[model samples]
Target: MTLLAESPVAVGPPAAPPADRMTRRHKLILTLLLGTQFMLTVDFSILNVALPALGADLGFAKENLQWVATAFALPAAGFTLLFGRFGDLLGRRRLFLTGMTLLAAASLLGGLAQSQEVIIAARVLQGLATAMATPAALSLLTTSFPEGPLRSRALGLNGALLSGGFTAGALFGGVLTDVLTWRWAFLLNLPIALLVLVLAPAVIRESRTPDKVRLDVPGAVTVTAGLLALTYGFTAAGTYGWGDPSALVPLLASAVLLTAFYLIERRAAAPLAPVRILNRPSVKWGNLGGFLAFGMETAVIFMMTLYLQDVLHYSALATGLAFAVPGVAAVVAGLGASRIIGRFGSQATLVGGLVVQAAANVGLLFLGTDRHWFIVVLAVLGIGFYGNVTAIVGFNVTATSGLPDEEQGLATGLTTLTQQIGFTLGIPLLSSIVAAGAAGYGSTTAPALALLGGIRLGVAVDIAVTVLGLVLIAVFLRRAARKNAV
Candidate 1:
């Protein structure tokens, strides 16, 4: 039964009343959960523009600053799924609040951090907090909202948040950094978290599974370690050289451990991997394309902000203004996506977005400027202005509805993990690629132009690869259509 079905079943032993009817109180709870998610996402995206300012305050070098971002991503990536499954087994509400506490503390510490190590450490703590809180937040939302129009409406708003955050982050980061201080970026969470924390217990109901399930500690550890090691490997490769033993060693171990994890999941009861989802070509291809798109998107904003501030010499606010296209585009896309999907089918929409994005990338390539200023390149950059998130968000809501309610916890967890891991790993990889290429240019115009050139090519490659992924979508969707016709 969808969470939105408004028939009153008696309230159960676990918590939260059975939904037979709607109440204003119920909507209030949903709002609190959504607020939690928005805060986490905003915190996640806000730091991109603020990174340069952060380095100035903390004295971290250009090369090492990736760690600041990596610190949050690595642990968050590692822990999300593992903790998510735990929430499935244990209790979502308990994990949710616990994570909130830890995340809040880390944010406080991060705001006060004086050195690179301290900031990095705080970031990892922040990651851990989000790791616990994020899945719980999703599971709560999915469980609370009754399926159908209400759920769809709620999910659409949530989808807006996934990209809406970028706009808020860019604008807010520049504002906070310019006026108050870069540390305020981290500190800003305090009030928002404080607001939600106060409201959660009162508004949100407690929830847990009725039956007992064994916790998969071994599976969780190995997978978490594997992801952490892999991320560490990719991140260190940029600095210590790709061939460095320190970098290569952990990555190899990550591979072995993950392989073992798959084997374990195959046999284990209540498997952590959820084998059925892995078998779908739609899910697999979607995840691959999503990763590439996310990585490229991060690079778009991260390096662009650098090009704007460090190279082009734009202020934080101007830099934020420069990105108005993506934020606005994303919001429009989110609102209209259902109708678009209805008209075109998922496959067509996916292809359309990629084609548009590819054009944006190519435009950026040809529109290069000798100066760092973004004014000239804004129109060009608009070409690569597409994302898989809106499509995927809808897919998730629809597909997972067919799934049993108990399974939705990890369903939400898995999608979140794919995007986070992609962002965590993609940023360093793309940035490093651009940096390496820039080094080859060796002249003033050559270096800046090289950076733009590399990104342009990166977007071109994204376009090609995305269109190729679209091929899979076309094949699969047609096959589905034929089967449905039969």
Candidate 2:
């Protein structure tokens, strides 16, 4: 019955030929990993549209309502590096399974929560779970697939699903809130998480660094503290004004803690993050590109959502439908990115994608008052979404393409950290710009028209930021490309 026993080849010297490429089983594993990432990203944006309903139901004060999002963002951003290192020290598969279990529990708690505090706490748990799971998933993905083109293609598809999650969340958030309740947003994760848990153990083989290693507690503490401080400061600056000590103090402390982290890493017996890895141009510049790509894109989505609802008077369902086309386009972009990058090269592909995003933001400048504009806006915005998705794939591939097996988790963690910080910062920074525009518009225009003006101003700022990001990609990625070619 056994093929080996039936064959002429002996068990010792001559052996059966092994498969060199990814098989169906490998593909299934990739699907499971990508699906986990998709679920996490969807949760990130789903809350935006449901905030009002949630606040009213939970009787949350206006200021406290932000905690629902902040709770998730802070720990997710802070603990990612720590968990990523843990994945390398412990078994990545074990950490991944644990994270999913915790995430499922947190989702259930949040879904059933009656008070804002309880939901916020659940979100904090969700953040911690995400922090553990994402880097491990990414690490496993890199190790499972062969490096170079195979890994690049896998990263491309991963990028696509991740981008699709955000777009889908924006669309579905409204639909769910309208049809059912805000709680469904949290509850939806339960089935998906459970499925990943059941399938992961069977499909994913365990991996770790062959050499024994210990966790670097000092590095972990300082880095986590620094990131937390930085995230909190940026988020608070958006809400409470940048001049407030509440914002300024954390920023100052972040500088100190971050510097201490670097010093600790330099002196540690086995460093948490190796300095040589950080020194890589691809890792540094790639993350900057990722930060810009995510930050501007999320800000655009937020502003557009407000414009559609407040100015155009669209229903929640209509808004979701309006975003449907662009969301699909984003997914397509992700799926096709590998082929595009292969033809064009990662550096060229990155620049081209940023250009597309900038041009789309320019298109938003001409937004009209009537419903007829929705078709034009969505189409143009879809083009931008396409560009962002491509850029995301490029950045991911660029960042991890050069790393050794052991540092894969570190590379992936840093990438996700930039993305989370981008999401956290974009809302406040762009919102401040919109607020400034509103103040400048004064009483000359009607309230709706004034809001429109502010939104336009915000889009213009986004255009400028997109251009700046393009410059960064041009300068840094090009250098990295040349270095890698040598």
Candidate 3:
């Protein structure tokens, strides 16, 4: 049977749930799910601000400090698809609870670690926990709420809190490190995880694919290895330059492994990612839109970070404070995104959001060394954050709307993978552009000017990429509409 055979159409707010059914119980379930999501996202960036303190306390070599973050990110990105499929085969609630348990243990271990190896090991466990939990939690959320304003609202809150968590991590990491210790950053997860463990079984329902399907081990292995290689390659490129063998070798390996995965999926009796699902116009275009939206937004944030610290010379605290504006904007956008999608439909919201984001990048082209320009920078970032959040919600709605409950895990997995890959690759790609732009200016150019030139170049590229994505999404969605009509 074709699992995702429905004609791909633009998703609008579907029929609303009965007023009585939309009760406090539903709200509690949403809070639990969103809280889980928030904790995972917070772990991604919480260590960044604490890196210095962590490295000093652990006696980490300067060159090896990146590993702390990389350890968590690599497994989180690489194993997500596999674990997502597992959630379908096993039970989502079971996997989710297990992941939460592991996360709590890992956090405790990391907080109490005395050596570098132990801390890195703990981070790896945490990464594994994230990989297992994310898609499971997401699939649960999507399945729990019926397709309509309810799901849109849940997704909007999900996107908003995801952004908020990253921002909060950075903000709180610094404060926690200064006031108490870096260990508290990891220890914080313990309580959150414990709370989820206590309440989840009571609120979240268990779900899995009803059909008994055999696992596609080859497909799983190849795709997991491929993603790992791909993520590691980009990360290495960010640190060691694109030309370095450390980046080149893995990039090449990733290409080969991913190709093998495609071939395996075509032949596998029960493919991890079904070909029919992937071939759907909504799934294909929606994911591409998500990839572009997330990649460019992350690239912009990295560039802005450099601009704030290197050219504008803001202290770390000052820079974090400045970004709080965008964080708040994301929350506001999240609050309103469902209403907008309900009114405009997902297609219009997605396209409009991308356009607004692109326009905001254009505004950043004017950012310069003058201190007064910081205001413009903040304003545009706030606008961009709002657009990004809205687009993210639209992406989630569009990509997963037509799929059956049995396939929700795979659908959520693909959406989650796009996000992780976008975050993994965005910085390196734009950093390369920035570096090339600066290098073209030669040695005699003022250091700050060269960096500024590079930042502008990166922003321009962000604008171009967003525009291209908008065009592609519009064209494909239009084509899908015509095909459905015929």
Q: Which candidate is the best by lDDT?
A: 3
Residue-wise C-alpha lDDT for candidate 3, range 1-486, written one tens digit per residue = 112222111112342544424556668878998999988987877776677679999999865777787888789888888887777777788889999999999999999999999999999999999988887787777766676777788889998887667666666676677778999889999989999999999887677666677778998899999989987887777567788899899999999999999998888877777776788788888988888877888678768767876788765566656767777988998899988988988877888888888888898998878888889988998899899888888888888787675555556668888876676567667876787677668899998899899899989988998899889998999899799999
Model 3 TM-score, 2 decimals: 0.89
lDDT of 3 at 306: 72
Per-model CA lDDT versus the true structure: 0.66, 0.78, 0.80
Q: Candidate 1: lDDT over CA atoms?
A: 0.66
Candidate 1 wrongly placed segments (more than 4 Å)? 1-26, 285-293, 342-351, 370-389, 398-401, 404-407, 442-446
Where is model 2 more than 4 Å wrong at Cα? 1-21, 403-409, 439-447, 479-486
> Model 2's lDDT to the true fold?
0.78
Give the distance in Å from residue 290's predicted Cα in candidate 2 to where it truly belongs: 1.5
What is the C-alpha lDDT profile of model 1 across 287-406, one tens digit per residue? 554554555555566667766776566798778777776666666766776566566654555556555654565545554455643655566444454344454445444444444444
Name the 10 consecutive residues with the lowest summed lDDT in model 2: 1-10
The candidate, 1 or 3, that scores higher on lDDT is 3
Better of 1 and 2 by lDDT: 2
TM-score of 2: 0.90
**Residue pairs with clashing backbones, model 2:** none
